[model samples]
Target chain A: MRIALDAMGGDFAPDAIVKGAIMAAREIDEATSLLLIGKEDVVNSLLKEYGYTGNKIAVVNATQVIEMGEHPTKALTHKTDSSIAIGFGLLKMQQADAFCSAGNTGAMLVGAMFSVKAIEGILRPSIANFVPKLKGGYGVILDVGANAECKPEVLEQFGELGSIYAKYVLGIDNPKVGLMNLGEEEGKGTVVVQAAYQRLKANGNINFIGNIEGRDLFNDKADVIVCDGYTGNIILKMAESLYDVLHEKGISDPFFDKFNYEAEGGSPILGVNGNVVIGHGVSSPTAVKNMVLQAQKMVSSKIWERFKKNYNE
Target chain B: MRIALDAMGGDFAPDAIVKGAIMAAREIDEATSLLLIGKEDVVNSLLKEYGYTGNKIAVVNATQVIEMGEHPTKALTHKTDSSIAIGFGLLKMQQADAFCSAGNTGAMLVGAMFSVKAIEGILRPSIANFVPKLKGGYGVILDVGANAECKPEVLEQFGELGSIYAKYVLGIDNPKVGLMNLGEEEGKGTVVVQAAYQRLKANGNINFIGNIEGRDLFNDKADVIVCDGYTGNIILKMAESLYDVLHEKGISDPFFDKFNYEAEGGSPILGVNGNVVIGHGVSSPTAVKNMVLQAQKMVSSKIWERFKKNYNE
Candidate 1:
């Protein structure tokens, strides 16, 4: 298995990305190899500077860089030789099993949709972030910023997509899907959410656990929570802030520590034809390493294939 | 000052409410008195059983009771003698300085709208919940479970309303108002949110701080956070859950303890003609006591008159 990573993506870029890759190399499966996509000279020199003498890490030349502030589509179109563009190029050509980045989130999303594209029957590709469950495992929440707004149909699709990911990648059996809303009652939510609740309940492919409130996030009620991108994004950032606050206060717990983004590293773009993960822009070495392992899990599970089969077959 | 409370409301009912009233009578301002509304016989017996001999606690007879599951509008209409109905009646008649309840949330909202109603020029009344900032003092977020969806103008109004509450009641000076969104960029978030951002920025009455993300909830970015009811409700519940989880784990901290509903006691209904607060349905005696004290604060601040002046003047 080959995992293509954007070494020139994050705030720390080559420095943190390279160091994280070295750490991940020590623990990653022997069958898996790392493809570091960036300016070949910069990545290699950094690797040498970091005192890395490992054979598992290789540099793939990409001449241009997509700065974090650049427009996603514009950068992708103009900087064809950028690390992100090249990483997606490798995935589309089957040269890499998965592609991961800690750079531009919008670019990673646009790259996934434009290059490998959504599956045949998928209405829209969604971004799914991992939810740290109170019982010591992770659940998935989708549409976490991909589509600021989603139709009832799109939300229903997220339920199925999140369910597939949870069951296959996270290995949760018959995962319970819950719609995040203001209240648990069937009729209690915005017009769109109320409609989405009905659609999720009608669908039979996954276990629909009715509606779950925000308080149910860390509980054992639902393994897969579905909401529009606007809501999901807020929840994700809020939980991340909780970790920041707790850590700042020197209040550390086994469960609260999971609130740290570095614990899971990256969010996956589901329903796309290939495996893709987008890490935090300020990702540290540990975060980048975990992002790589998350991608490894996604590739090994063949989640994209399951999505395709769920829709096409 | 007379503060009317629904003695028959909440899961604990007359027992906890009576006991809570007794506790609140001790700490409450000597000028303020409690009007406990419920079945006269039952409430008096409970008051006697709880050994409350305080002259500040008075009982008003209400023959009926509104159960938690009853429809808000229907119960208020048919059960005129219900404790919730009588509480609203006293507020509408100006016989009570403020009214508070640990009862059905829907009923509380319905009662506020049906009785004293929204202040003149107020588009919609909103429910505002206290935010436990990472620092020391508290902030306020509005439209929590009151209006599931809000228009751009309604959101702008929330900004002003919350600003008033924070400054006048919470004691924040020149309180900053922020529109909650998926991203901090002015162009980000759903269409309604984007438009709301524009309206908030254009409005000259309040100190608009532009858009704030979920991570900024506890930060010093904005003392008054504005959002549609759906988002605010989710955030409020999620924060409540955080407190519950921490308390259950026996992990106590000054900041986390503030997350408890008992700390603030109830969410105030802003933009209404009268001061009103709705407490948690399962409120403990401490929570009930705090609820009464919160109502006292609202009455003393004369927040409803301030709302009238803001819009009517």
Candidate 2:
């Protein structure tokens, strides 16, 4: 298996990216290869400084870099030689089994949709974030800012997609899927949420657990929580801020420690044809390493194949 | 000024409610009175048990009590003598300067809408929650579960309402109003949010600060944040959950302490024709006292009259 890493992406670019790629290369089996995509000299010099001369690693030069503030679609279309664009190019051509980047998130999503494209029969691709639940468990929440305005049908699909992800990637059996709503009652949400709740209940593929509210986020109420991207994104950012508050106040605890973005690495774009993961723009070396490993897990599980089979069946 | 306290409402009922009213009455001027609305005999007994009877306090008989789980609209209509219903009745009859309840939130909202009714030209009544900021400051967030689904026009009104609240009540001069969105860009949100952003920007009545994301909730990016009730409700509950996690983990800090519900007392229903404050259902005596004091401040500020003038202007 070949994993492509956008070495020029993230706040800690070539230095942290190269170190993380080397760390991941050492941990993966001999069968797996790591391709560092960035300015050839920059990545190579960092790799050489770390004395990382392993046969399992190679560097692919990309001339341009997409800055964090650049317009996503515009950057992808204009900067053809950028690391993000080239990484997606490699994934589309089957030269890489998966692509991982801690780069401009919008750029990554754009590349996934326009480059390798969405999986067949998928309405739209969604991103999933790992939520650390209480009592030493985790849950998956989907569409975390992918499609801010989703139709009821799209939301229902998020339930199925998130369920599959929890079951296959996270190894939760028959994952309980819950629609994130304002209240626990069936009719207790916006028009979209109410319609989606009905459809999700009728979806045979998922274990519909009815409505779950915001307070249920950190608990063991459900294995998979699904909401429109607008709501999901807000929760994701709010959780991040809470973590920030805890950290700033010098408060230390095991559960909150898990809220660290580095622990989850990156959020995977679930409905795309190929494996793609987008990490935080300010990823450190540890975050980048975990992001690579997350991508590896997705590839090993044959997530796309399962999604295709699930949809077909 | 006479403030009506729902002595039969909240988890701590007549005891805490009556004590809080007594505390408020003693703190206010001699002309102010506390009208305890509940089982008159029970409330009077509690007041008597606390100390010698004072002329500053009186009791109004309300035989029926609305349970927390009862349907809001149904209970308000059926339980005419319930503390919540009678509280509104007193407000409507000009017998009370303000009404405060720490019970059946839905019932309070229903009573406020049906009794005093919405202010003229107000699209809908909204509830505002005070968000504790990091640097010893606070921000006002609105529509926290009042209207689950809001149109663009209604959201724009929230900005104006929240701005007025921050300026008059919180003492923030020309508070910067921000429309909560998935992204900071003008067009980066759900269709409704994007439309609201445009209208908020065009609205000269408030200091519009474009868009604010979820992470900005506890930050100083905007003094008043506005969103549809659905999103606002989710964030509010999520913030509450974060506070719960911190408390459970024994991570005590001054910043986290501010997350306590008792600090802010209650959420005030804005855009209503009268001053109405709703506290937590499980509020302790301290929280009840704060809620009463909050209502006192609203009445003293003549918030409703100011709102009417602003809308007219």
Candidate 3:
């Protein structure tokens, strides 16, 4: 399996991305190849600086880089030869098994959706993250800013998607899925959540754990938590803020350390036709390395195959 | 000033409630009195157990208790003579300057709406809380589950209310108010939030700092953050979960320790006709004492008077 890396994305750009690619190419098996996509001279210069020499690692020269502040659609349409577009195009053409980028999140999302397209039965692609709770395990929150306005059925789909991820990627069997609501009672949320709760509860394919409030997210009350992109995005961002604040205040723990790995691993764009991971814009070399490894694991686990089966069923 | 306490509310009921009332009465000057509302015999018995000799804490007989599981409206209607109802009734009759309770949140909210009534010029009363962020000051989040559906105007009002609290109550001069959105850009949120952002930005009365996303809530981006109750509640709960999870994982910090105060200090019912506070049903004695102190401060600061003046302006 080969993975395409957008070397011109993120704050550290070519240097961190090139180093991460070289590290992964060396550590990963021979069958796992790496394609570094970026401006030819810049990427080549970084590769030479690192003194990297390996058959597994290759470079694809592109001429443009999209700034973080540029409009995603406008830039993608205008800068057709940019590193992000070229990398995603490569994945679309089956030249690479997966594409990973620590770039403009909006642009990455747009490019992935436009190029790779959504899964057959998916309404909208969602993003998932493992936020460590007060309890021993991490709570998985989905749709963390993919589709802001969601229907009831959309949330139910997130439940299915989140459940599979928790079980396969996070290594939890029979992961408990909870619908995010204002209260724990059966009818304690907005009209959208209430409808989704009923549908999720009736779906026997998932380990539906019923409704859970925000406070219950970190209390080991459930493993997989599903919500609309709006609420999910808010929760994820707020948690990120809390972690930063607590860490700065000398709160020492594994959870806070996780915050230090700001770009440790990027969010997987679930429901897409291909393996596409969107890393943080500020991601460093270590984060790029982790994201690359995460992509490799996801491919090995055949997460897409499981997603297809579950979605169809 | 006299404040009525619901002695039969909360997880530790009579004991904690009665003790909290006594503590408040002792801490505050003789000019402040507490009317403990509950079963006369039970309250008197608990008061004796604590060996309270203060006459400032008086007991008003109440025969009914609202359970957490019961419906707020139904419980209030059925148990007209309950502590929660009677406590609100005291405020309605001008017998008490304010009311405090660590009881069924929904029940207290319903009772306060009926008895205390919303202040003129205020659309609806919102529940607000202080989230300790990475910055030295806290982020004031409003509408944490009060009104599920909100208009653009209501969101703007929340921003104004949050700004006032952060400035006057928390002592932050010229508090920066941020309209909660999906992104920090001008047109990055829901239709309602977008419209509200424009109004807040144009309004000369408020220190509108523009839009802020969820990730910025803890990064000192804004002192006062405002959103509808549904979104606000989700953010507040998520933050609470993060703090709890981090703390449980032995993440030691003096900042988080301050949250140890119970929900008994209750939420100050913003946009109300008078000073009214509602605590969580699981509040501890310390929370109740804090709520009592909060009530006194609200009264002395003439928050209502200032609100009316600002509304006219």
Candidate 4:
């Protein structure tokens, strides 16, 4: 399996990315290789400075660099030779098994849509983040910031997308999908949520486990939490902050430590044509390494193939 | 000042409420009194059993009771002599300075609307919960579960209502109000939130800070967080569960300890004709005690009067 990484993404771009590749090289199996995409000389020099002498790693050149703050559509359109653009080009052409970026989140999302594209029957592709469950393992939460205002059908689709990712990528057996809402009642929540509840319950493709409140995010009630991007984004950020608060206070339990973004790795773009993950913009070397490992799992599970089978077949 | 509490409300009912009243009696000043409204004989016996000889607490008769699962509107109308109804009646007739309950949340909200009523010009009354800040003190978040779907104008009004509550009741001067969104950018979030941003910024009544994200809940970015009840309820429950998770793990910190609902007391109803608070259905004696004191603070601050003054004449 080959995982193509954007060498010029995130706050600490080429340096951290190169360092991360060095770390991941030792961990990945001999069959898996890292294709580091960036300005060739800069990346090569950084790799040399990092003292990376491994057969599992290689560098690919993309002359231009897309800054973290650039607009997604415009940047991807104009900067065709940028690392992000080139990374997608590699994935679209099937040259790389999977692609990962910690760069502009918007650009990563836009590139996935334009290149690998959404699954044929999929209404909209979603960004799925991991929620650290108290009992053990992580639950998948979708549309973290993809579609802020999702229609009922879009939300229902998230349930399906999240479930497939959970069962395959995360290894949850028959993942229970729950709609995020204020209340647990069948008729409770906003119009969109209420409608989505009925649709989820009626849908036979996923294990629909009624409505789960915000309090249920960390519980074992659901392995796949479905919601509009607005609610999911807020919950994801809040959980991330909890980890920060605990770490700052010098308090770290194994379960609470899992709340760390680095612990869960990067959030994946589900329902796209390929395995793609978007790491935090401030991703550390460890976080990047974890993200690479996460991509390896996505590739090994053949998640996009499963999504295609589920939705397209 | 006279504060009326529903003794027959909450899961523990007359026992916890009566015990809570006795606890409040010792903490309350000579100027403040608690009118425990419930089955007169039951409440009086429980108060005596608890060995309360304080003159601060007195029993008031409420023959009927509103069960926790009953529909709010029907329960209020059919059970006219219910503890919640009688408590609201006392507030409406100016016989009590405030009313509070841990019974069916919907019943409390409905009774507030029918009895004391929403302030003349207020679009909707909101239930405001306290968020424990990392620095110190608490920030007020409004519309927790009152109005699940709020318009841009209603959200703008929440900014005003929350600012008033934060300033007067919580004793924060020049409270910073923020619209909760997926991103800190101006155009981020759902359509309603986008529209609310413009209105909150334009409305000179509030100290409108720009949008704050989920991570800012405990930060000093905004002292009063404004969002629709759907969003607020989810955030409130999620925060409460954080306290639950931490407590179960036997981890306690001054800041995280404040996440306990008992520490924050109860959610107060804002932008109403009179001060009203709704406690958790499974409220413990300590939670009920804190709730009574919260009612005392509301009465002392005269929050409803300020709401009326701001929204009405």
Candidate topping DockQ: 1
Candidate 1 lDDT over A231-305, as tens digits, reads 999999999998898898898999999999999899999999999999999999999999999999999999999
Q: By lDDT, who's the top model here?
A: 1
Candidate 3, B20-68: lDDT as tens digits: 8878888876688888999999999999999999789889999999987
Candidate 4 docking quality: incorrect, acceptable, medium or high: high
lDDT tens digits by residue: candidate 4, B48-124: 88899879888899999999999999999899999999999899999999898999999999899998888899998
Each model's lDDT comes to 0.93, 0.89, 0.81, 0.91
DockQ for every model, please.
0.92, 0.78, 0.66, 0.86
Itemize residue pairs with steric clashes in candidate 2. Answer: none
Q: Pick the winner on lDDT between candidates 2 and 4.
A: 4
lDDT for residue B71 in candidate 1, whole number 0-100: 95
Local error of candidate 4 at B128, Å? 0.6
Q: Give, for candidate 2 chain B, the lowest lDDT window spanning 10 residues.
A: B23-32
Query: Which pairs clash inside model 3?
Result: A134-B245, A245-B134, B266-B278, B266-B279
**Reference-based TM-score of each model:** 0.99, 0.97, 0.95, 0.99
Q: How would you encode candidate 1's per-residue C-alpha lDDT over B1-110 as one tens digit per residue?
A: 99999999999997888989999999999899999999999989988888888899889999999999999999999999999999999999999989999998999999
**lDDT string, candidate 2, B71-184, tens digits:** 999998899989999999999999998999989999999999999999999999898998888877789999888899999999999998998889889889989998887788
Error of 3 at B196 (Å): 2.3
Q: Which ten residues in a row have the lowest lDDT in candidate 3 chain A?
A: A255-264
TM-score of chain B of each: 0.99, 0.95, 0.93, 0.98
